[model samples]
Target chain A: MKRRTALKVAASAALTSVLTIGSAYGAEPIRFGAVAPKTGALAAGAAITHWPNIQLWVHQVNERGGLRMKDGSRRKVEIIEYDDRTNPGETIKAVERLATQDKVDFIVAPYSTGLNVAAAPVFAKLGYPQVAATAITDKIPELTQRYPSIFFALGSTTALASSVADVLAKMKAEGKIGNRIAMVNVADAFGIELAEASRPIFVKAGFEIVFNRSYPLGTQDLSPIVKGAKASNPDAFVAWSYPPDTFALTEQSKIEGLNVKAYYTAVATAFPAYGGKFGKSVEGHLGAGGVNTDTAEMKAYFAAHQKVTGKPADYWASAVTYASLQVLEQSIEAVGTDRKAVIEHISKSTFQTVMGPWKFVNQSIDKVWTVGQWQGGVFHGVASTGLPGAKPVIVKTGW
Target chain B: MTARETRTLILVVVAFALLACLPLLRHGYLLSLGVDIAMYTVLATSWALFSGPTHYISLATAAFYGIGAYVVAAGIGTLPYPALVALAGLAGAVAAALVGLATLRLSGVYFVIFTLGLAELVRQIVTWVQNNFTGSRGMYVLTSITERMIYWELLALAAAVFFIGWRVARSRLGFALRIIGNDETVAAHLGINSAACKLALFVISGAFAGMVGAIMAPRLSYIEPSIAFTSELSFQVVIMALLGGVHRLWGPLVGVIPFTILWEVIAARFPTQTVLLLGIAFLLIVYLIPNGVVGRIESALRAAQRRVSHA
Candidate 1:
């Protein structure tokens, strides 16, 4: 019996050794896993947000002799990314595979709000601390309240909406804007949440929301929505949209010759592609953003980002992604290894990152968030600038 | 037992033991790769039941999978795991039967297009359903996951599918289905009940596919239209069956393991080049091994014997 057991064990061990040869090929870098859309509709946004700062951070850290460990040793940061293809199911599968199979030290969740929401419980159950870079929703706070191991770098949805309202109020007080507005959003959770949150804010700010509509994502034609919003004769058009929808709405608005005095959008509006694509038409447009050259820290980050990424930082999503990496770095440094200790480290402490300072209120829930906007090709930080190092950049559109 | 029988028994026992011990043996990426193998094997075997025997290709296998997933997710109210899985399979069969009835009259590439069109239509439906049933966001079930449970579930499902494939290969239904595949008009003239065989195969294929999806829905703890129903995944099923020598019992299992492992290795190390390399490999395989990896090897060995006999 003993001999049989011993032989079986030996055979298993041999197979295991042969299988893990790939793991032994490289020096154990800080094994980090990222869930990004490598292909599909959102591939460009995914690349811009997930890859750039990661490469930048990896370069900077390698320059400083890589990640510092508790044992006074250093290892280079290595990222293994799976393209979720902007699919939530794929994202969850990738995260699980990363957690149970690759056993990476840290994992970066997807940039899509939907993808992140779908993946939250999986990460939480595995006791892996997932830092969400792009998923910002009102539901996150409640989700965080339940899970405690998940963290969001940005301000919560309510806080972000209130801050946008504050900015709009301030702009109005300064006589730069009026009370008439039209709100158009994608018929998706992220867009719907933003529109819902903003509705109350707009009401509180005493602005009449003349036209409000929720259109589907990936909808080819937006002429109807533009025409309707145009006919509403609003002072500003507030759009909660992704790149495709943003471009579609912008094109349709231009085609229809809709003369809305001001145009503002959510997500990816700060991308130079937007400005580059639309040019003079996009000059007076406003969009949400986080990373800008307003502060020394931000300026330094922008320079580093530009040098490494070979492009200007687009939006706050990229900064949030970088900040997530920073958290992963700190946690790994504190715990020495990734899996069990990393979560514990992240659960109980605060870390400084690209978004200034992020401190989780409860380790299980997503509590921290903020809102940003683009002003003259810059993502001006308008909300959640109360962190230790955050510098607010307030701006007015149609200048 | 005869030597051949004993050899088969030994191989079976060894495979079972390896599957049982997979979790204990490998962790992280390797373990996931193993799970992927099991998943693909199940998918291929199920797909082969329809395409191999009856010659009716389903481009909407993934749509049935999505339907199964969404139903289970939506119906998780008070059902047990087995019950839920059964329900999913039933739903899939019903869906396949309904679609098959409508399109079975169309033959050749038109049938293919109809199935493809149906799959796309289902995709749109799921996307629309996602808004109401699973929220505007992606659907997630907040629950605990055990890798061991998933691994074993997949193993059990694969074994069940292997048995079904074995029985089908030997049964009368299998011969009728095979005749239909070779020449439907001839089989129909000879009173083979062509439509019945095709519809039966279609439903059987859908059932197996649905069971796999039901297992997968809870394992990943999430589901979406695109993830549950991608053309790539559907193609992978056919690829595995083709590479392994379709219509054979062990073919899909054999094909999926090596290809899946190779894919993982390439994807992990050289992600940008993985797809390109796969394309090249596929081209090479088609040119060199027209009958697939297994068929080509057997043919080569047979050719060598023929040469020796001539000598």
Candidate 2:
């Protein structure tokens, strides 16, 4: 009995030792938590513009045998994802759970301005360098001034808003567009802000606002509004819309045959499905864009994105996500595992990403804004004039 | 406490202790799970108050919950965190009481519509406030979030909500609510003052939801129209209460824990199929387990005891 007991004890000890060494051999994987609206109203936009770049980065990094860690070792990057159901409260709760509960080394948030706003303070407080991919509002920079840890990937709204006016001016000077303009805005925070900012600039540049209307944000039917626009007989129709609202308004406008002279929208203008949905109808449709189609680097990125995701990758927000990822990698490379150090580095340093280069100018530097518009199925960079192959597309009036 | 009461208390205490230790467990993932459960626990218990007692379906709980949250965000500049949270609860209670007075006259479906109207109104008000307060830029609390702080705060709020539920269940108010629940007209005939009781219940329940909102708003560090108030949230609370068992004291906790875990699992595992599955599961629960899992379990146990005694 004593001999049998000794043998069993020895066997147990051996098993424990083996388990300990096995755990030691397996280095802990670096986990990054991503939260986005996988369902609900935001899902369609998220599927097209937001999710693929994350999967792209994950696959690319993993293909190279994962990220190189500080200890001269490589660990696979594990992504723990949650669908926020397009609810801000749920997104906030998910982000908190992901940060504090999941204890992810990094976090990638969704493309909603409201959701990003909800998560910014959480990420900043935890000292996590959150790459807020698509959602860009003027409020982000103001928040960044107070909390230096949060950095925005997308171009500031102030730039896009005023630049739309500048783009209209350039088109008007070319004698390709009419003098009359009309505005229709969704009555949400983001839409309202964009419309308000774009209005003064549009007026200052000699564009007349003939008809203006603000509909409630979730108004599913826009035929009445579009019919009213048709009655006004404006040359250009400028709409400030959310993603779902964009599709609804655009589809309804087409149905009503209220094409007018030029059709333009904000938010999901650069979506591939938008083009695929309308075909020729969307060819001349204009909106905000971040990158140009002709750039070799952008082309390569899109090609890679298409190869990996099996979906066309040419939206403005995805460019922002791609740029944010580049910035994140650069920050991690500079600061190594220290989150505070990374935040400080980002605050002080100008990092080169796919968005050309971004420097954290004084929280007051609102002048370096940019805007882009689509023409012939390609988005043309309009503002900040030095970009290559960025000749302005002037819209000629039928009236 | 009696033997049965003592055993129940011990079980509850042990469960809470496990929750408290979860943040310090092997991974932060577990901590997040704990936070989700804790938040649901608060929401579930508050939802149970009106649904279980008076049977007056207050779908406007989400509105009050959101009001409490935004009030905290709006008051953060002026009030301390604890005071701000308390004030939010006070505000929610007042709003609930006022709403109860207006709608308590209705019954069944009409009551449901009245509450729905209140929720829609609250959503509109939230949008208007966001537009005015933040200059049409979404209202974001310009602050950083700390995990440990929010975890502890949520835990405290959860405890406070459960405590309120426990006190109400054990007090004279419980008997009054039970009478009202059997039939409001009959309860009023017995001088139960159904309107007064409902208003008080609304105030109490609204305060619990408000407390949760106050704690959660600061954690998110941002608030907007859709974030603070949504019909979906009201439905979630109601579902949680139904899953737990409407009349039973322990139903909310039972419902919240399993529902939250299942919700996370579905989200993490299936990702795309979660909503469809949740809908299907809700349908099944409504059909298969009408009184909820806990209520069914209790009934089964009682029948088994009777069989054993007869034998």
C-alpha RMSD of each candidate structure in angstroms: 7.0, 6.3
DockQ of each: 0.17, 0.39
Candidate 1 ranges with C-alpha deviation above 4 Å: A1-37, A67-129, A137-149, A155-183, A187-216, A232-236, A283-293, A331-342, A364-370, A384-399, B1-14, B77-81, B132-134, B304-311
lDDT of 2 by residue, B16-90 (tens): 777677656545455556666787778778778777887777788778888888887777777687898889889
Best by lDDT: 2
Model 1 lDDT per residue over A1-399, tens place: 999999999999988996685365344677778877777666788778777877888888878887888888877776777776665555666787787767777777677655776777667767777777776555555677766667766556566666667666666777666888888888654665567677878898888899988677678988999999989988778888877888888888888877655577877776767777876666556566545446677678878888888987766677777778788888888887746777677777888776666676664224333545555565555554454333433433332
lDDT for each residue of candidate 2 in A3-115, tens digit (9 for 90 to 100):
99999999999999966754653666567788888887678778877788889878877787766755667666678788889876567567767776677777875666767
CAPRI grade of model 2: acceptable
C-alpha positional error of residue B48 in candidate 2 after TM-score superposition, expressed in Å: 1.6
Cα shift from native, residue A398, model 2 (Å): 5.6
Q: Model 2: DockQ against the native?
A: 0.39
lDDT of 1 at A303: 80
In model 2 chain B, which range of ten residues has the least summed lDDT? B129-138
Docking class of 1: incorrect
